[model samples]
Target: MQIFSFKKFLKEQFILLSLSAIVGILSALFIAFFLKLLEAATAYRNSHFQLLFLLPIAGWVIYLSYQYLGKNSSKGNNLIIKEAKGNQESVPAVMLPLVLFGTVITHLFGGSAGREGTAVQIGGTVAAKISEWCKLNQQLRSILLICGIGAGFSAVFGTPLTGFVFSLEVLVIGKMEYKAAPYSLIASLIANYFCLQLGIHHTKYFITSSIPMNGEWISIALKVGIASIGFGLAGYLFSYFIELFKKIYSKILPKAWMIPIFGGIIIIILGQWLVGKDYLGLGVDPNYPGAASIVGAFHAGGSFTWSWFWKLLFTTITLSAGFKGGEVTPLFFIGAALGNTLATLFNIPIDLLAGVGFIAVFAAATNTPLACTMMGIELFGAANLPFFAIGCFVAYYCSGHSGIYTSQNIGIAKNSFLQIRNNKLLSQHLSQKELFYHKKWTLVKNKYL
Candidate 1:
C-alpha cells in the first residue's frame, strides 16, 4: 500500500508538471504573438501619424467589441487576480482574443499603454481552459492560474524569477503565497525559453556604476529613499487620476461611446499641440529626435523634467478612456524618466537613478516590492540590490493603500495601527475608511458647535 501510494504521488506530480509546461508553452506562444503585434502596430503608428486622428474611431471599435463580446472580460487584470484568489470560478476564453485585439488596436492608434495586461489575460484565459480540460481541483486550478500568469509575464519580459514572485505577490497585498511556487517557477522558466526560441528578445538595461556601501552608502540610501517617495507619489497620482478620469468621464459622458472619442480628441490635442508627441505610444524607444524613451533615460540628457508627468497624464487618460493595454511598461517609462530628473537634482549617477525609478515606481503602483526588486536584479544586475530593495520598499509604503488593481485585497494591512479589514478589497476598504472619516469628522464638528 505504501509503494502504491508513493507511485501515485509521483505520477500526480509528473502530470501536474507536464500540464504546467503545456500552459507555459501556450502562454509563450500567445505572448510572442502579442509582442510582435505590438511592435508592428507601434511601427505603423509612428510611420503614419495620420492614424493618430483615428484614435476615437479605434476607441469606438474597442468599446463596441467589449460591450458585445467582453462580458466579465472587460475587468482585465482584476478578473485574473480574482480568479487566482478563487473569488471567481473561471476566466473567460474570449478574454484571450479580446485583449489581444484590443491592445493591438490601442497601440496602432497610438494609445499610451503597456502589454502586460494582454499577456496576463492570455495566460489566465489559457489556464482556465486547461483547468476544465484536466478537471483540476480548486487547489490545482489556482496553481494552474499562477503558472499561467508567471509564464505569460516571464515570456513577455524574459524574467522568469521576477515573474514567479510577481505571480505570488501581485494577487494580494502584503502576502506572498508560495503554494504554487514550484509550478510557477517551472512555467516561468519554460515560457521564457519558448519565447527565446521564437526570437522574442526583451529589453536590456545595464548599470555600470559602482555603488559603494562604505562611507557614502548611508547618504546614498537616504537620497534614494527620498527620491523613491517621489516615485511612489507618481504612482499614486497615476492610480488616482485613472479613477478620477473614469468617474469624470462616466458622469459627464454617460455614454461609453462618447467617453473614448472625447478622450481620444484630448489625447490628440495634447500629443500634437502641447506636449509634442514625446509621451505617446510605448515610450520605450525614441520616436522623434531626442524623444524620451525608457532606454533613452539611461544616458545623459535622456529626459526632461516634465517627461514623467506627461507620460503619466497620457497613460491615465488613455487607459481611463477604455484603451486596452497594461499600465506596467508605461509606469516603467514614467519611473525611469522621473529618476533621470531626480538624478539631476540629487547628484546621483543618472543610470543608477533611472534604474532605481524603473523598478521603484512599478513596485509602488503594484504594491509588490519584492517582485519589483527581483525584476530590478533581472533587468539590471545585482550590484545595486540593496538600493533596489530600499527603493522598492520605500516606494511601496509611500504609494498609499491604493493600487492600479482595485480587486486586490489587503491580506495584511501595510500599517498594523490602522483599522484595515482583513480580506476586503482595497476599493472597499477605501470606501469604508472614507465613510468612517465622514462620520467621525461630522460628529466632532457637531460637538464643537
Candidate 2:
C-alpha cells in the first residue's frame, strides 16, 4: 500500500494524466465505432422481423466463434473484474473484437441485451494490451485499467462522473480505490468529450420538478427510501434469477450450444405470444406508439404495470442462453418501468421516482452505490441529491452480497455483523454460506423430522 513521496507523487500523477488522456482517446474511438455498429445492426433487425427466427443460428455462430477464438476470454466481464482484482494475470487481446462481434450479433438477432459489458471489455483489453507492450509495472497497469474502464463507461453513457466513480468503486464492494481517482476522472472527462466530438449521441433525461431540500424534504427522502427497497429487490431478483437460470439451463441442456438454441426458441415463442417485441432488443426503443421505454417511463400511462417483469424475463433468458451484451442498460429499462408503476401506486412525482429507479437498481446490482449516486446527479441533475443518496444507499444494503459481476471482491461487508472475509470474491462468499447453511439444515431435518 506504500505510495510515493510528494515529489514522486507529483511525477507519477503527471505521467498517469498523460497516459489517461491517451487511453481516453482510444476508448472513445472504440465506443463510438461500436455504438455505430450496434445502431446499424439494430436497425436491420427492426426492419427484418424474420431475423428473429435466425437467433438460433446466430447463437451457434457466436458459440463457435468463442469456442475457436475466445479461449478464457469467454469469461466476459468477470475476467475484467478478476484481472482488476489481481485474481487473473491477463486479459486476452482478442476479447476486444470477440465481445464486440458477440454483442452486435445478440442485438442483430433479437436478443434482449445491453452495451456496457462490451464497451468495458473493449476498454480493459486495450489498456491491458498497451500495458503489456510498454512493460509497465503492476501498479501502473492496474491504474491504466481503471482509467480504461472509466473512459469506456463515460464515453458510452456520457456520464463522466459516474464513469470516474464506477471504475474505482466497482472492484470491491464497500471499498473505493482512491489511488486511481485522478486518472479515472481524467480519463472519463476526456473520453466523454472525445465521444461527443465523434458525434456519438447519448440519451438525455429530463425531470419536470423536484421537491425542495427543506424541512419537508425529510418526508420525501423517506418515501424515496421505501421505493428504493423495491428497486433494490428488483435488482437482487434480476441477479439471482439470471444465476439460477444458468444453473437450470446447464442441468437440462448439458451442452453450451444447445442451451442457446432452446433459449432462442423460448424467447421467440414467448416474445411473439406474451409480450410481443417490446421486451426484446434493448427495451429502450418505442418501436410502436406508447411502447415502454426509459423515456416513456417519465410520464404517466407510459409504462405497463408488468413492463419490468417482462424486461427482466427477456434479459435473464438472453444472458443465460449465452447471448452477448451487458445487463446495465436493460436494468435501466426495467428500473424505469418499475419506478413508473410504483409512482402511480405511491402518488409520488412520476419523474422523480423513475429517476431514482434508474440509478438505484444499477447501484444495487453493481454494488457501486457511490458511482450510481453520481450517475443520478450527472444524468438527472443535483436537484434531488439527498433523495438520490438515500435511494442508492438503501438499495445497496437491500441487495445483500449478490451482484452482476461474480468476480467482484467483498472488501468490506455491508453490515459489520455479516463478517465476510476481506478480499474474497462475492461468488466464493455466497457459495460458502450456502454450503454451511445446507449442512446445518440437513442435520436438523435428520435429527427432528
Residues 1-449 of candidate 1 have per-residue lDDT tens digits of 44468887787788779988999999999899889988898888889978899999999999999989888888998988888888655687888999999999989988899888888889988987999898887878888888888998898889999999999999889998798899899999999999999989788888888977787888888999999999999988889899889989999996779988989999999988888788888888987879889999998888888899999999999999999999999999999999999998998899999999999999999999999999999999898998899999999999889899888989998888887778889889767766889999999999997
> For model 2, what is the alpha-carbon lDDT of residue 420?
81
Q: RMSDs, each prediction?
A: 2.3, 2.1
Which ten-residue region of model 2 has the weakest summed lDDT? 80-89
How well does candidate 2 match the true structure in TM-score terms?
A: 0.95
Query: 1-449 in candidate 2: lDDT tens per residue?
Result: 99758998788777778888888999899899999999899888878867889898888888888889988888888888777665446899889998998999999989999999998888888878887887777888888899888888898899999999999999998899888898889989999999999999888898877687676677767888899999999999999889888888989986788988888888899777867888778766764666788888888887889998889999999998899999999999888998899988877899999999988999999999999999999988888888789888999999999999988999999898887889898999878977999999999999999
State which candidate has the highest lDDT.
1
Q: Give the whole-model CA lDDT for all candidates, comma-separated.
A: 0.90, 0.88
Candidate 1 residue pairs in backbone clash:
none
Clashes (candidate 1): 0
